[model samples]
Target: MARETHIEAYDGPAGGWGSAKSVGRYVLGEGAPLRTTAALAKQNKVGGFACVSCAWSKPRDPNTFEFCENGAKATAWELTSKAIDASFFARHTLRELEHWSDFALEDQGRLTEPLKYDAASDRYLPIAWEQAFAEIGAELNAIDPKAAVFYASGRASLETSYLYQLFARIYGTNNLPDSSNMCHESTSVALPESIGVPVGTVFLEDFETTDFIFFFGQNVGSNAPRMLHPLQEARKRGVPIITFNPLRERGLERFTNPQAPTEMLTGAETTISTQYCQVKAGGDLAALFGLAKALIALDDAAAESGGPAVLDHGFIAEHTHGFEAFAGACRARGWDAIERGAGLSRAALEQAAETYARSTAAIAVYGMGLTQHRTGVENVQMLANLLLLKGNIGRPGAGICPVRGHSNVQGQRTVGITEKTKLAPLDRLKELYDFEPPREDGMATVDACEGMVAGTVEAFVALGGNFLRAIPETGAMETAWRKLRLSVQIATKLNRSHVVHGRAAYLLPCLGRIEIDRQASGPQAVSVEDSSSHFHGSRALVDPVAATLKSELAIVAGLARATLLPNPKVDWEGWTADYAKVRDAIEATYPKVFPGFNARLDTPGGFPKPIAAREREWTTPTGKANFIFPESLDENPDMPAPNPDALRLITLRSNDQFNTTIYGFDDRFRGVDGTRMVVFMNAADIARLGFADAGTVTMTTAADDALREVAGFRIVAYDIPEGCCAAYYPECNPLIPLWHHAKGSKVPAAKAIPVTLRAAG
Candidate 1:
């Protein structure tokens, strides 16, 4: 049952509609089982839409057909009837769509007009959305609105990211830069510094009263496959789950639930983690300091045999403060350096601290592999010091969860699309739009890629992503997005960041929350928040192959009334055709966490935002609830001296890929069929590097001034972990280097690099 890995052609990376798999079988062909049984009977109902992939949390049930399998390839890559119009741009030519392949530039679908990027007939011409908002308000009023940045994409909406952060702070500039500054900006900078709420204290009936789930560096079966049916219904109600990851996923080891019909007619599959622990790549702060020094040696042997006292002492002495400086930094760390920096063993961290001391409602749940590392905000302050040492935040099935990966990236940071300068979101943007927003620090996707490679960025705009191929220095982000001077995006399809061009690009074309936008104050309803802080309302069930598109909240209220009007006091043209006036300006800005956010997104299973109803009270700045003692348990903060003839490499993801979406090229859980430049190795490093298990190799990098090499590669030998080795992610993202990040989430901790094999030459 392992021969089926066909790949007749699959060009990687592109706008994610469930990121590639033969462009979701050519945009969901054969009527993807009747359009996913009529769009999973309107998931999270009260108007449907949302599941454009990831950010798990739904149940507003119109009838819950419960989507998954990358939410039916993101609703068949946006109900694909594939378009691209304008005679495929009068026969392609942005240098032949830059030699087409980022999955043939989004498998040439949608996007009907509002083009621009001419650069003297290199192509893409069709303009006129009022001449693309008067040439983006004359190149953003001739730059210096803090060099015009703006970013956003977590699939926008929440009234187009609260009117594109209220037109980039009313034309001043808090830059906004998003894609959660390249993934979960460390859970909004470590759960609001440990719980005055950044987000996720757990809800979704806290997985039906959880008993233990931990999980980390999340992979949730190809990234949030409907969170593998609530961890397979909390492992069929016995609950355990565990996992930590260094790749060994299959939706965390088995899944199926094709919305169950006798488990999809007996193809049966539900297994989900009952302990998996691999932990290494940036050894999650030495596996959360070896599970807090094995729960402080099982709470000092249950207080020297006087039974009952494995911690939570009366909810950590009334909702915790600092537990004696987090139990003296987990007793100044030891136990053979936490079992040699968490490669696991203090008897498997005391069997994961006796399943977290017989959990009374545990959770943890993390993702972005624990927030793209370098101690991603000290790993969300050690999962809020293991859920406040067992009092488990706001209870009813314990908390911490992070997950989130678009689908309104936590409702575009719950309406603000941050770059963090909040004083109650700048005093609720001076009481709902009088002005005065620019308080300071903006630009965060690693300081907007070092401010577009240090040229003090000039006009980026995005709104919907694919930003320089989801950035990480792919050839210095295609030469700093061809030296932008106006890039713009607001897309619906055609990716490679719209054929890389920048010196004045545009592309516009919007509308796609599954369609039906309509406008002139009629059938709309957008919203989208997920990953627990619910929020809801989406609508659009199709129909709109371009009535001249436009509805990323009316193209951010027609480019914020062509860059903030001469007399604009926030009616950005009636909040772009009324998105309930951008939910009354995010309910006058975060009213106790978006209270009654648009009448609780018009009920029936929508609302929920307020958090930690009462637990680890911490919005940080020492309101106390922090504990992350990192000095060193080095999960390769650039591991080097390990050249016992090379072998570290890690990079993964390939159950028919998703991030950098390559849908086709069968990875069918590593029995790898078609091809993605193979390379798994570990048959004793291919018989001591003499290679032959399936021939063809070359890999490189042993550091010491070495940049990279990654030539051809075919070596097979499977079952990883010897000196470890696996590859697949931006096709080994050219053997990861862009200053090999992770020191505070610069990210690219591509598992944990090192490399060296050989044999093909």
Candidate 2:
């Protein structure tokens, strides 16, 4: 292939010349330097579009160059000058395009028209929007509403998301799963039970005064590079940052702000973390227990000596539940088990505890690493327990921060996109629309796949996403997708998902976030919420690439109109004509939470949504924060005994990748060049496993079936902890079974896969 593997040392600080060069290459290489350059300038700025890459909230006062390398790439990729229309689709058959990679399919450029799959010719032909919608509506009307799966990606704005979910509920199904279900569903599921809110309580501005930042799991450099600036500033202010991760991430270790003239001119690097501990894969729960245990031990010592209280007694008594049982459970877990399970020394755990105890306000930040495990829900709860020991939640510069990857993932979920029945406020929907909402639980990401495999899921409607590539068991999902009777995709561009169509499929082109959406009223602006619950308006940077393109909101409304013809309850036409009406309807549904929604859109840097947890107002059933006691130190209970010979495979994303979209094959952060078919292993493990450095090896899963495996992966010596290995995601997705997911959250346990390796023949 593209060179087996080329590993080198990447000692340079993150976000320097390397980041700048990558941004330059991507933006300039789009063949529309001026157009792409202008789009980058408008990103994250007032009255401009939000960055479609990551959901990091914007500062109250944004910089002139507020975008990061990933943001630049996403912006450039969307603002491409290339166009692929009906003629191009006619030239390429679906079977031929099935062989193309996801990146190659999207790189073909934007979908220019509504097209229907022609099974006889194995090609797609242009069709009128009304005709396509009518056909799709007819098919959906014929099937049971519960059998349809309505999926939305994070790229959808709040306006579109609201309408999209409403459409699904009105169509008689709660199968409203979105991109958030795949990534941060654990945070969403656990945080509410632990702290009475599904989202993190810390604000973007909280970084300025935070005493300590405990970063876990997430690599900010690749996922959300804009986060580095605040962390670097926190370091400059002498705030000690403690990091816990399996791989030594370059972003969490050191960062040089590319926007800072002095750093760029002098090539100066800012040390991000005071201490970095390499926690084993799927060891976050054990590590959290260790930290909590240390905190309790310190408190016990202080109590006897009449010293300053280590635990916040007043806060615990006033605003918490289950502290006694949780603390006792922590005391029972010995240091030996903690150290063994966490892959960290007692000294490191104690040091982290000390740092955490000393800080008046600390923010516990995490990403998919903590959430993508069998004990993902427990991982979040354990983290909350640690934060509660020092009363870190619901205060300025404190609490949890589960960083989101998609731009408006949290927003989409906030505006009623979920598989759960009660989360959508069915009561309000009925009161407003006078329709009976679905009460039964619906299909999530995994359930949707199972439904497809079982021939029960008749139709699949995706707003935007590479569903096949994003889901687990890629091979199985790819084949099962063909079982669907209808597959309707509303997207800005073509992707591999389009090629792997159902029995009948339709591709409807929609306007991109960067393109101006001129509805019947006038140019309309959309809104999105960041990871921190900050809501803001996003206007277009340029005109639509094609005249035939429609806004996502319009498309969803059009489909709803076709499906439920002559429905007087929902005003789909009015909502599509003017998006302000949609906002008004949203406010009508959640008035207290979204009052003056339309007027607030003009706020300079947007407004922060009200979070009950941030105000220490616990809205849980207990009316206070609750401490959770995990079942065991071993997060992966399904996993057998901890065998030293077995390797826990953790999936990673390259610096040049975003989700399933591969920008390039170069990952400067890990020193991987020109190839993604490589696995990172410790030097000792390499020798212990009897594999030479850079030698090709085949990895087979240790599951009961033992069918999941990948061959021809080069083993590169890395600095990871023993008994663990790392490889790029989506490439290794084939080895992950669809059933291997978190216990409660059902999120794919991608962080830790049991596997074994042997020399490739």
Candidate 3:
């Protein structure tokens, strides 16, 4: 059932009546207009729940309408009038639902009760909470603890994540793989090596004072719309924003404030980026080297001419190491190589470098575009090196900003949800909880998938998220998942992962962020850390969508109690009765970062956690920031060369999509409507490939081994770099092999896959 496809030039600003209308449509379609409106009004407000869409921090003095268009969609989706109970499952068997699209599976409505798969009828039958817990526990006890894997979603709250990690360790396995492994695992691994911290150093207020903002490989408009407000203000105050991406994102070009009635009524739009650079896919390292090369040349000329040195020698000498080696590497990079790799002329890069040299305070903000590659860690480290050259860090309006996707993805890591467990946190948990925590490192997402495929993993439990849809090389991963003895998902709605089950599967419905959770101690609140490391409390304003749904905390506790059968040490029931107890345990675990966690919620906007890089208090092994020198421009040397007709394929999210969730088929910002299977290509590339605009084509991976292909993709000619093409993910995910990923980070190299386009068969 393909809808009518319509393509129109999206000349209007990013957010305006268009956003408002989208929200209205979703809310009305879900039959929750008034409820959605009231819930949205309270979102991001004092003592209100935070938006679960993106990790953008809320303002201290909040606005009346603080939610964005996507935020409204998420809220409506969670609070929809439609419900999926035992009756609904009886109507449609798992076989029938397996053939449905991802959108259709989730749009069927929210899960209302606990379900257990009945193999005989291929349907999910209602199961009591206790029975589900007991059966899950029995399966856990039957298998070796090391054979089970616990996967956590970014949407899980800090308290729930803390409890989840604790449960995994106590059950005698450290195979904990979370969403970070798929997204910002590179940032967590690289930043600490370069700057003594894994998270970004910029605060929310830095946008107001920064002289220049460099948006490298990020789409702020669709991914984080709330950020448009700050960018808009910066534009009004004469801040120059430079964007470097393979595709020109409209969100970074112009934006109209949806919250401003006057701007909405008059159709006034604010111009965002002063310049846009379409760098080649997987060429971020080259572009970064070019900028550094330009800056180094400028500094040398300035010194020879008896002018003030352009480089921040004072800060470099005082707070950083390995400057000479790094400088040598920058000088050695040839302009020809840089230009060829970046797909940009030397003049364009130099112009951008000139802005960097002049500005005293600038922020380099990036998203997955810079991190989802084989050189992901190096990409982040190079950005740090660039900022260090100009002394941009530790200043009021300057630092590195990695805009996070899920609301609490960073927060989950802050709490104990990590594959690499530290001894200090383990000791703290042991001392407080009176149990021996596992000292061994755990398996990350990629590792866990491999373990399952090798028949080493026996059970899989997901807190949230569509694990099958989110991970790359789904064809093999799905086969491996079916080999497991037991599988469980704690979710709010039905997804592809639920239908694609193991030998025995369970679906435990949980309350969403927008729903109220009343425990023995009264209404409860959960905390989430935003992208900037700002910790705030989120409390639900409305009742739970389903009466039988349980909070994630309660579900985790139930599983813990059932699994820890003999002589269990911790009191799982006590923690679930009151969430404050969970916070107290978290404060005890990470005292410095989460000190006075319970009392801090009283503050209007939660406090920003201490960042060592922000204060020049480097906690690295050298007690100072280190400038790392890469050996060459090609980070992944083992990557096979593409065929002459091959184009670098980069997977992107549609304007109406977030991560893996599809709200609609239309990608309005890209002038795409009623379709998600379209690929954007340069007009010249299309002509060279002998393909007409709007013609159907199939994209096949051009690697040495493992042929993967996606069929029936309509070609759309657009403004993009030559030798580079873009398509939506979960659809194109098959083309990315399981072995193709960042070296150390294991994040799928989604931005730099090699593929060839051909006419549809």
**Residue 412 in model 3: shift from native, Å?**
0.7
Q: How do the residues 581-630 of candidate 2 rate in per-residue lDDT, one tens digit apiece?
A: 99999889889778999999867667888899988999999999999878
Q: What is the lDDT of candidate 1?
A: 0.72
The sequence of per-residue lDDT tens digits that candidate 3 reaches over residues 198-298 is 99999989988999999998998789988899899999999999999988898899898988899998999998999899999988999999999999999
What ranges in model 3 sit over 4 Å off?
Answer: 566-569
lDDT for model 2, on a 0 to 1 scale? 0.89
lDDT of 1 by residue, 1-761 (tens): 12343432222211122223333464456244466457656755676776777768876543345656556666666666678876787787787787665665775667878888777767788888987898788889987898778887687777778778777887888878777666677776666666677777888778888888888878776677766767788899889878887667666776666545675555566678878888655567777887887887788888999889887878777656777777887878887876666566778777987888888889888877667655677777787787788788878888888888777777777677777676227776876567777788676666776777787887888888676666654666678878978888888888777787789988898877877887778878877888887777778886776788878888877887887766556777676676887787777777776766777775665777767534545656766565555567675655567888787677676665556655456665555666677877668868876778667777776755746666667777776656677777776665666666556546555666677876775
Q: Which ten residues in a row have the lowest lDDT in candidate 3?
A: 565-574
Pairs of residues at least 3 apart in sequence or in different chains that clash in candidate 2: none
Q: What is the C-alpha local distance difference test score of candidate 3?
A: 0.89
Candidates by lDDT, descending order: 2, 3, 1
Task: Specify the poorest-scoring 10-residue window by lDDT in model 2.
Answer: 1-10
- Which pairs of residues clash in candidate 3, taking residues 3 or more apart in a chain or in different chains? none
